[model samples]
Target chain A: MAADRVDPIHQFHINTIVPIHVGGYDLSFTNFSLFMVIAVVLSGGLLYWATAGRRVVPSRSQSVAEMTYEFSASMLKDSAGNEGMRFFPFIFTLFVFVLMANLIGMFPYFPTVTSQLIVTVALALVVFFMVMIAGFVRHGFGFFKLFVPSGIPVALLPLVVAIEIISFFTRPVSHSVRLFANMLAGHITVKVFAGFIFSLGSLGALGVAGAILPLIMVVGLTALEILIAFLQAYVFAMLACIYINDAIHPGH
Target chain B: MFVTSAYAQTAAPSAIEAHEGVAAGGGHEAFPPFNPEYFPSQLLWLAITFIAFYYFVKKVLLPRIGDTIENRRRTIAGNLEEAARMKEDADAAVAAYEQELADARARAHEIATKARDEARAKAENDRKKVEASLDGKLAESEKRIASVKASAMKDVGSIAEDTASMIVERLLGSVASKSDIAAAVKAARE
Candidate 1:
């Protein structure tokens, strides 16, 4: 018999064109680049279309668009307060792009960029840099004072600062890992269940009966994954808002 | 040797052995490393998204919310003003009704008082007429009584003179003097 198909991990490899030399480094766009572009265009177009008419009494599309805007706005306000308004556009855009990329992947033959660590990490890095810059700009030299809480004894300051810095550095890692792990685990589970359905189907009547169970599981998991995709986007955006709050008013 | 080699090639590798072999041989890079400088397109799109959302919130959504709130406030104010005006109108109507009620009561009282006074005056006039008629009747009855008494006294005097004449005739049995009889008759007649 022909060799059984390779495990799904092998399929995750990014294929690219000739690597471009840039500043003594190889930089090449891959399938992730294509998906990111697609996500951007689709998100932009959907929002534009949804809000194009600007009706006083909102149309269905406009209502949906407004709901999305209000949802993110309220979330930011809840997490970061009025100071969060300044970061609304960035947070909203990030949320929409991530949500679109995740949903698009559910379609046949579409790639999920969120499954890639690089994309998730890059997005997390942007959030990280923005928080850093905002803290520096707002608090100036006092930004470093964030690592030390007020009322702490001098003897405990060193230990407290070390812990605070470690926690701070782990923010991006956890942020990117949350998205990446969710997408990877959901997709792998789906693939494994699909494989079960095919592999069990060939055995006999009992095997066919057994295959039905996995098929049901696959369908259920698919639906659940779709919900997770939306939740992940929301979580990502809300956390970014929270981080921004810490930057705006550190040490509290 | 060829048959043995073909058989060996046809046998499948164990899962762990296959995984180890793939790990050892799959050294070829699948893709080049990502560089931030090459992702200008992504950065540009990010900028575009940022600007679009910024404009949407600032120019569109925020203004709409403000306008809706302002309109609601204006509507409430207008309704309150209208209600206040209606209340004033109702109060004026009540006041007018009360004033008209007082006027009607006063007019009715005035008319009743006049009717009562007129009835009293008419009663007084009727009483005076009855009293005058009664006094006149009393006067007439007294006059009639006096006239009747005079007539009765004359009749009695005539009778008395006749009786006295008869008595004198009886006492004188023979033919009395004609002159004496004549005198007696004349006295009776007088």
Candidate 2:
């Protein structure tokens, strides 16, 4: 146990396992990179293995894989209609990556890649660019129409458009921060309470009895963190779909 | 292992000095993810992994699953359509069979009636011919009887004449003329 230091932020540290210097830049493969790779591989391997059989009546694992597909697909369809199916693969990839990363972080010794701002920002930027490109490609110059609301008084149009544009640009930032903050906070809270159990035990014979409360808190926090992991992943994917809807139907 | 790492970081005087030195130089040591040093690497790996996974899902897995679902739907729809067509064909066949059976029954009845009528007409014609032949025979017999009766009456008349002549001969004891005898007989008969 890292109960002595009791610094929850230490878990987010990126230690380079293999340092690589490229053109005077430190591009090392750290613990963060390893988990990111694990997330990708696990998600890809699961889908491939489940769909390899392709039985009409799905097997247990196949249903799991199909359920994931249907979940992301329906989420996109519901937010953006039939046209949203074009981005199903991208949104699904984003979902599984974040989900697997969060889930693996719940275990000991595994770091949460989604907890890192850089990683979440990277994923959000992908959705951001996809929305922009899709918007421009489909609607051309009319993509700028996304900022303009219909039935607004002409006098207030400028202010409303400015607010809409500001909000639009902030999409990626808020999208990334939501997932990153949730996972980071939940893990830190659990770690802090876990440290409490050990710190109380070390005080004295009488302090051992006091450790029971933090111990129960740690147990409860673990369950809540697990739920947060799943919820954040779902929320991240759902918001991405909603943002993409703006691109597909710019007027809306 | 985690306890040892924590102890090593905190207990080692050199590690503390290094941390202070790095912290004094810049705030980069405080946040590793925000540090410019690791962003390129994280971004690089993320791109590679995400693109690979995206293609795997888009090109490979999705098509296979879609194919299975589509095939199942097509099979079910085709089966239902074929069953309906078969039902319709069966219904038509049943109707045709019933029609043929009724026609055959009607033809059989017509043939039976025609045969019975022919037999009755032939019997009627035979009876009429036999009646005609019987009538001719009866008429011929009746004519023969009439002739015989007439001849018997003539014989009876001759017998009476002879009886009358004998009576006259025995009573008068004289021979009479044939014409006179005949005339006396006619007067007595009258």
Candidate 3:
């Protein structure tokens, strides 16, 4: 007797609120937009509060905030070098936004913005474009040389080049899909298992007893979802830095 | 069945035109995630929010944090340098103290050795002076004994001559001449 409200797909649904259409597009402030604003405000507020004192000896929250900054900064530098520090703000924002979205989605009935294919695609495309424009601008035609690996057999060069080109073009798809799919699948699987609890409990005594199994499964899955949330954000930000590194120094 | 039924709405001119039907609770038969109707709004909002977030991070958050971190590092480094300088000064003071101690000990040893040598030399000089005065007194006593012995021998000789003269006079029943007695005694002594 699991109702339609438990529909795993229903959580991803967008219902328009405060409908605003300009130039024939539904740009209405939906739940997604509301959450996005919430995420921004929350993250910004956290940073502000963490940095309020800036003492010689940092407070606990101040140290945490500093660690996060250093983590993002080092990730970029390790992958992309010192020049990569220039993109630290954007990378940090991307990292914080995705992390917040994923974490907030852990709450029941909250929509994960990152779960949307369009949102992830937009983020990936931004990185992709930054890479492309910066690559071409910095290296010109030499950017294409990235596809050409050094020390390749003449006969196999074409095959390797083709594979490299395809992989390069598909970077955004893979990058965006990795995060989107992790969020979508994690959320959906948890919902599906949650629905099982109701479905099983409705079967009477034995069924109610069996519901504990799914309940445990939901707990474990939620914990895992939290891990995936942090992991996916890290992966996204790390790959973005690596891609930018490729633009800066494209080679074998 | 839901997916196939919703595909029928795709024939509606454009994505924007079709969203109205979908948004109006038009019995969603299509896969919700794959629905293209939501892309524009999501993209637009993402642009607006992401740009705003980036500016907040770049302008406000980053600089504030960076400065705090930098200031903290500088403060620590300055403290470390100061500690090192203080340690160096302490080490120098200790070394100087040890050097001064060593010099004082050596000087004390030298002064003690000189005082002992001067005392020994004074004692030796006093002993030599006493020994030399005692030697002079012993030599004078020996010379006086030799002269006294010679006088006693001369007295013994004169007494013997007197006794001889008395015996000669007794034998002759008259006093023999002193010259004759003396001549006889001298001849007998030779």
Candidate 4:
């Protein structure tokens, strides 16, 4: 019982809720999918309900809604300039979805959606392809100038181009890995520390006192995870804005 | 390797298949996140939710929020403009009041100056008229006194002449010439 309780891996397990098989694919709607839908409804409904008043002066809830909109808008504009507002919808959606998922996962027994490699990978790929397509469409063949910095020694030009190409291609991998690893590792650490509380509390008074240390650590880590949830969402959207900016202006 | 196996074992697909799937790859299946079987479903759902979210934001959610914010901004701007216009009106009123005050002061000063000049002129005119009448009365009184003194001197001269003729007649005890006496008196008067 203690071993399974300490196993943080079980929390990430996918359970088939409503199994739907189409063609040869097993496109089953699992717990992860349920959480995604929840994220959608929560964010959408909150935004819709919060802004219904449309008060000129703004109430407390209205301020929250406006703050969310301004936060994403300013971040995108800051990173990619005013022209970057073109991709505001896509970038804002990603931010809200990821942020909602991270916050929801903070609850006991809630599966973290961003912890999945597939989900982050898919998000990153979308940004990557969007940047590439925008770059090609805007600058045409001149988009290759991104890899070739203007002030470079002729002899080192080939090496520089190779490094730039590799880094550019690996953007999606590092981007996805950063968020996935953070969520997975943070959840595991929290769970592992929480398991100590259960095990030590069963050992009587002295063990209860000892369990206090891990309990404090769990509390601190949970707070840190909350901060990181906002941070990761901001970072992801900001990075997307930067990539889209690169596509909009394909120079160094 | 066991995508079909998991499908077939759907009746009891919870723990046994998961462990079996892990065991089948000789521990190569490793972490649950890296498993390929769940990738399709997670990706598919992610695509659905994200796309739906994107559309909702683009169509419904964003417009509402944007309109609220825009409306607030416009209201604030309009309020500020009205306040500025009111301030301008107040300043103009104050200026007009001050200007009227200054004009009234200037008019009062002009009236006072005119009244003071008229009063001084009237006083001066009355004083000059009194002085001219006094001068005329003094001149007439002096002329009357000189005429009375001249008449008294003529009477004294006539009496003196008569007295001189009577003394001569008494001393000589003889009748003298009347014409001579008259001539003597006339010469004495001269």
Candidate 5:
């Protein structure tokens, strides 16, 4: 019996496919890079294929492409108002990329790009910088008035401003971590349960019997993970829109 | 349920421990997404891919979709407008047809009324003409009848005179004068 041969954390290990060292940088092509490229190819290729025909009555691929476009357009319109539509291209790319990454991750042996903290942080930072730039460019120094609300009592002003400022700064942390932690935790839990099945199977007949519960759990968790995969993508995009909305309409 | 052998159970734990040691961050281990070594490459690739994706979608896919959607929308709107215009035209045509029918009906009724009035007047004139001719004929017949009655009366007078004269002559053995007989007949008639 080799019951303890299963390792759940092993799935997260990063391996360099092409080890390249430039100066002090480790710019090697990696599994993470591969999946990001795959996501890009899949998303971009599908979009290209979908709109290649440009039929008045859309094909299925065109319908999918149109729905994706409309989904981002409407999300921006609803969250950030009409003015936010100027950022449509950026938002659309962000949404489609995240969505593709999440969906791709659901497949076996495919890694999730958004699961990487650096990638998510980078995305969140893009939104954060955009918000600051847009706010400052539009409102100048008055953009700081977003921390202050209307009709507050004099005594409670300090407390409210402090809270608002802290919450405002926490946006990127929450934004990135929400996606990263959700993907990491869900995958890890699924892996741990899956590991249990293999480990218990090594205990012969009795162990196989005990493995049934973990097997069922693993199956249920996989389904849940798929749901989370879609949901986290949506949440990430939605937050990006909301944050962008703050820049468009400062002080409200 | 079949139980596993005790020896297998004991062996399983050792194997599991060896697996954990091998898995637990040895030189072979790359500590997942947090691995500082993978960050630069991932970010670099992400930037390149995302920027390309943004431009590709913005430049190519979105415009085509927009054209299709806008074209479909315009076509639907045009169709609706054309249908409405056609409906209005049809309504006008039907109204004109109905108006023409109403005018024809009114003209037909007027013609019928004029024809009826003319026929009634002709009939009245014919009746009056017939009444006048009948009156004239009746008057001529009455005049003729009066002449005939006068002639019969004169003849009757003459006959009565003759009969009286004969009767007087036979009885008296003398013939009476004609004038006297005529006078006696007339007096007796009176």
Candidate 6:
């Protein structure tokens, strides 16, 4: 029973050497390190190769690369307005990195960094920090006023501010958890159903018939995972846009 | 939001173990608290992604959108100019057609008027010719009548003279009766 029961979440653990005692902190790199490096190389190579010898009329590869660029540009413009153009580089990079990480994880024997809560949360925190900094930089002391609605009565100010602060703090948690949870759940489901098919196949005719159900489920779940991968990347980019919006227009 | 609840349900662990077991039993592994700082790969990626996207948007995407819009504007403007030119051409063609129609109408009127005048002149010439022929015929008839009148007068005179001669011969047989012949001549003259 112990061998038969597989822990889905255990597959996502990142094994590494604890950081060498440089000072007091462990700064050693891990499997997550290797995967991230691979992701960067893949993204860079693809983008560079696609755009290197661009003609007036684009080739298929160049058009795809350009489409990626345009898609993010339009998203930023719509969500964050013209000022969002300044953050275009950040948003585009985020989208590509997340996309690459998600796609790479779909391959056999590839680790999904986004499936880790720590990685996702850290990324979300950066966005959260940038949003706060941008708001403060633009509005100065008035940045704090974002928590309090303008038309609210003085008595209701405390209640609104508390709610706003709690919501604001939850942003990073929710953002990170969304990506991590989705990736983790999707991968686990795929692995478990795959295990079910193999485990059931060892039995006779009835087991063989039962194998078909898990096989079908595996195929269906795999297709769903691919969709979720794309969706997660899009959601990550979209949330970045929304956070940037707060910086550009704070009152709302 | 719907995804959040679903994730929460799936992620919930079965039970939470108390920490006091670690000090009392000393056999269980220490449970680590949730940490947000475990991953450095994410930071490196964040840097890479930020840099790459920054360059792409700056150099490629925005420019393409701008170009598309500019191209559309130019196309629209060109269409408008072409339409205006076509309208002018149509107006010119319509005006020329109207001018030609008017000229044809005037030409037709002129032709009808000239034909009517020519017909009137021909009729007048014909009436004059008929009147001259009638006058010539009347003059010829008058001449014939005059000659005939003269001849008839001559015949009548001759007949009378003959009759007188016969009467005289009968009355004055041989050379006697000169007074009788003279009286008969007087009677014939009276």
Residue A240 alpha-carbon offset, candidate 4, angstroms: 0.5
Candidate 6 clashing pairs, residues 3+ apart or interchain: A19-A27, A19-A28, A89-B53, A89-B54, A93-B49
Q: What order do candidates take by DockQ, descending?
A: 4, 5, 3, 2, 6, 1
- Candidate 1 per-residue lDDT over residues B72-134, each given as its tens digit: 567779999999999999999999999999999999999999999999999998898988898
What are the RMSDs of all candidates, in order?
10.0, 6.8, 5.0, 4.2, 7.9, 9.2
Evaluated with DockQ, which candidate comes out highest?
Answer: 4
Q: Candidate 4 on A151-204: residue-level lDDT in tens?
A: 899999999999999999999999999999999889988988998998898899
Q: What is residue A133's positional error in candidate 6, in angstroms?
A: 2.4
lDDT of each: 0.70, 0.82, 0.86, 0.85, 0.82, 0.72
Q: Is candidate 2 or candidate 3 better by DockQ?
A: 3
Error of 1 at A186 (Å): 1.0
DockQ of each: 0.08, 0.25, 0.34, 0.48, 0.35, 0.09
Docking class of predicted structure 3 = acceptable
Winner on DockQ (3 vs 5): 5
Considering lDDT, which of the candidate structures 4 and 6 is the better prediction for this target? Answer: 4
Backbone clashes in candidate 3 total 0
Compute each candidate's TM-score over C-alphas: 0.65, 0.71, 0.86, 0.87, 0.86, 0.66
Per-residue lDDT of A93 in model 4: 91
Comparing 1 with 6 on DockQ, the higher-scoring candidate is: 6
Clashes by residue pair, model 2: none
Docking class of 5: acceptable
lDDT of 6 by residue, A1-252 (tens): 434244343446444533322343334455666687677678767877776654545688877877887888889999999988888778887888888899999885677878877678877988899999999899997787777778999998899999999998899999999998899879889978977877788787789899999999989998999899989999998999999988878887
Report the alpha-carbon TM-score of model 4 versus the true structure.
Answer: 0.87
**Candidate 5 on B1-190: residue-level lDDT in tens?**
1212322322333343444535644223334555554577778888988898888888987787778888888988999999999999999999999999999999999999999999999999999999999999999999999899999998999889889988999999899999899888989999
Give per-residue CA lDDT, model 2, range A22-119, as digits (tens). 77655667778888888878878888898778787789988898888788889999999999998887888788888999999999778999888888
